[model samples]
Target: MKLQLAIDLEDIQGAIDLIQKTKDSIDIFEYGTPLVINFGLEGLKKIRAEFPDITLLADLKIMDVASYEVNQAFVYGADITTILGVAEDQSIKDAVKAAHEAGKELLVDMIGVQDIATRAREIDAFGADYIGTHTGYDLQALGQDPGGIKLTAAEEIKSANPDLLIIGGAISTVDDPATAAAEFKKLLG
Candidate 1:
């Protein structure tokens, strides 16, 4: 199986440094949502320039302006772009058209969709190259797994949505739960 590393919680340089280190082992390097949102497509431009031949996936989570966004991602060197499953069916179709026209792939991210089975079946008909899911923290609500979130993700998430009610999992699962909670508190509170 090919390993696709989703690189989030890192700035553009950090992501590039990571790809530089892991390129040999990873099949597809994903510039995740937070990274793209923080650094813009310039991150893609820089990474693509640095690794000209690597398979780069930009996790755009495109919910609107589907065709334009897909084309833009390709122009910036994304081998694959993403569309949200919750988006309108026509938007998904537009994205597929854009990807096919550019000889690239569109991955449909069913991150927050309610009906996974129905959406997956519908998206399968749209010819998306792949259908996938990401762990949406709020949706999953830490559910009892306490270590999947890293400090860095916490900080970025907090920064993006300051008023968001922060939750913790790693802290609860760690040997020193109090210490972990304190650290998150320091970073987020």
Candidate 2:
């Protein structure tokens, strides 16, 4: 089990500042979709260069051209890159191959997937380093709680493949992020 902090705000410096403040406690740092969209790949590079020891995940949420995008993410210093679960099978396979070849890891984001358990089982068998149940920002703003969804998905994935690392996102909205993160970390344990 690992505690991954997702940085989704607009400012790169603000994200960096927060990471610096909590660097010692978190297990992984995610350059969230908003941050990547705001600052490009440079956002990943800047933070990774500053904290060489922390594992960095770039939430590109790739849907196509997996190999090229995943490769580029690794080149930009991402230890892990994500792809959408709804993407074509070939794309997911390509992403996994690229990640493995680069000695990196791939996370399949099960965001819009209707059958998360089924897809998680398939992705785990296909060798994705992690299977994540992610709730989009819009969904979070609608007052949907991701904690229950995350736990349900984690339990489903754990039963299917205990070896696959399970990640839960959409936690930044929680009133007490520290307690929320700690509770999520315990899900895998």
Candidate 3:
């Protein structure tokens, strides 16, 4: 039931203000993919500086140069970093190792990856901290619901490794946190 607030858009200060106001209520703070792409690691560093106590996840959506990206994120104060499950197995392994070496966590983003079960199993073997059942913003904008998909992915990953932590993303509204938490509870039970 961890609530990760995704900060997207191009306004770093605006995002900082919102996070400053809401950080107490959220379990994790995420620098969204678009924001990271737009502002890079320095932007993530700024957010990290603002909230040193909070768990900061950088949604880098890393597809290549796994070690370098993960290292950069960790150095910039990211407690956790994300990698695409669709990426090469070597990349996933490298990133996972980098995360471990840096004392950080790795979140495998299972977005648009067809072999989710296989990838989940592989990530479990690599000891990823969490598996993110995520829907892209474009799909959400087109009215595709992520609840069911997230639940399904969570179930699949949990089956592979019951100890795995499942997180949901592309959750745009406030109501989504409760709904998703409830759904995840039911699935876990």
Candidate 4:
């Protein structure tokens, strides 16, 4: 029942301000792909320094150089780093290993890939800590539904590996949080 608040499009100060404002209310604080790309790992470090207790997720959307990226993220204070589910098996394994070595978690983001079953299986095989069923900003902007992807991926992953963690994305509004929680419950059952 963790609620991760994604911070995107804002500058470092703005992100810091938002996190400071919402830290007590949110379970996890996510640095969105755009913000990470714009500010780099330093952005993650800054947020971590500001909020030491909150779980910090860096949405790097890593596709290659898995070990290096994971190491860099961990060094910069990311408690969890995200890689693309569509990435090569070796890449996923490398990232997962790196994350384990650093005592952090890896979240495999299933963005464009439609075959949730296969991707979830692959990520689970690699021992990823969490699977992110995400709707990218462009998709959300185009009025796409996040529930379909979230439910499909959650069900597929739970069927394959009941222990795996399923994280829903494109959740910003208050209503979406309740919707996501209900969808997760249905999938778990």
Candidate 5:
């Protein structure tokens, strides 16, 4: 029931700028994978300093050293972080533990999971805070990826579950990011 805007822009300033523009409308602001790759956890520290109270998710998409990485993310001011569901079950458990200990959360991104139902139950048992389905989310579904499918599937997916959280990255590509976010908010409502 919240709008999470994924800021996959190149630099720190771009993330800050987009957050500034859409802050009022977007419920959660994400520091996407590219930002983490480009600026490291230092980028998250800077953004956290800028908007201390906003719900910020650092999409670390962790693959190894779950406890250390998840702890580092929280230390750098991430309210939520992620680990790939395709990772080892122990890694998933460790990430969830670290997130919970930090009073934060870990989203288990099911990008390449071969069997979603089996893994989802295991992830839930491991105490993951969220499960991210679809590859790179709506952007990929809308033909942004090589094997892309239609975005109409996003609506159908949403309609399937009442407890769903839909996060979008398309807002970052538009002329007016705030308007785009507001449109999503309206549509979700």
Candidate 6:
């Protein structure tokens, strides 16, 4: 079980500082969609330079041009990059291939896919290292909890592909990330 700290701040320095402060508590540092969109690969480069030993995840939520996007993420020093579950199967395959070529991992983000079980099965067959069920910030703001769905999908994936990682991307939405992460670790245990 790994605790990933997702950073969505517009300020790269602030994100870096937070990662520096919370480095010991989390295993992976995720550069959220907003942070990636706001600063592009430059932000990832800076963080990689600052924390060379930490695992950095680029949450690009890539839906198309999988190879190019995944390659760019790895080239910029991301240890893991994300692909959208709603993307075409070919795109998912391409992303996985790119990740393999880069010697990194691809996490498939199931953010908007309505059929959780079916899509989870399908995406799990795509050979991604991790399958993540995410509840975006807007949904979290509306008080919607996706933990149940996330756990369900995780169970399904674990049954089908026990080695594949199951990621819950809503920890950042929780009030206390450290406590939430600890609870997740306990649950996994």
Q: Which candidate is the best by TM-score?
A: 5
| lDDT leader | 5
**What is candidate 6's local distance difference test score?**
0.78
TM-score of each: 0.75, 0.79, 0.77, 0.77, 0.87, 0.79
* lDDT score, candidate 2, position 57: 92
Off by over 4 Å in 4: 147-189
Give the Å shift of residue 122 in candidate 3: 2.0
Q: Write the residue-wise lDDT of candidate 1 on 95-153 in tens digits.
A: 99999999999999888888889999999999998887555766456573333557767
lDDT of 6 by residue, 1-189 (tens): 566667875388977766765666567888888988899988999999999999999999999999999999998989999999999999999999999988999999889989978988887787888987777767877888743324345455445543333343444545555565555445442
Q: Which regions of candidate 6 fall more than 4 Å away from where they truly are?
A: 147-189
Give the C-alpha miss distance for residue 97 in model 6, angstroms: 0.7
Please give, for residues 46-85, the per-residue lDDT of candidate 2 as tens digits. 8888888888999999999999999999999899999999
Model 1 regions more than 4 Å off:
144-189
lDDT of each: 0.77, 0.79, 0.75, 0.75, 0.81, 0.78
Residue 42, candidate 4: C-alpha displacement in angstroms: 1.6
Q: Which tens-of-lDDT digit does each residue in 1-189 have in candidate 5?
A: 666777776599988998899888788888989899999999999999999989999989899999999999999999999899999989999999989988897888898887989989989898888887756645555865423222344575467653435455467777988887776666664
Cα deviation of 137, candidate 5, in Å: 8.2
lDDT of 4 by residue, 1-189 (tens): 455667776788977876665555456678888888899888888888887888888889999999999989888888888999889899999999999999999999899889998889878888998887777767878888653235556656566553434343433333345455445545554
Candidate 3 residue spans exceeding 4 A from truth: 147-189
In candidate 4, residue 97 scores what lDDT? 97
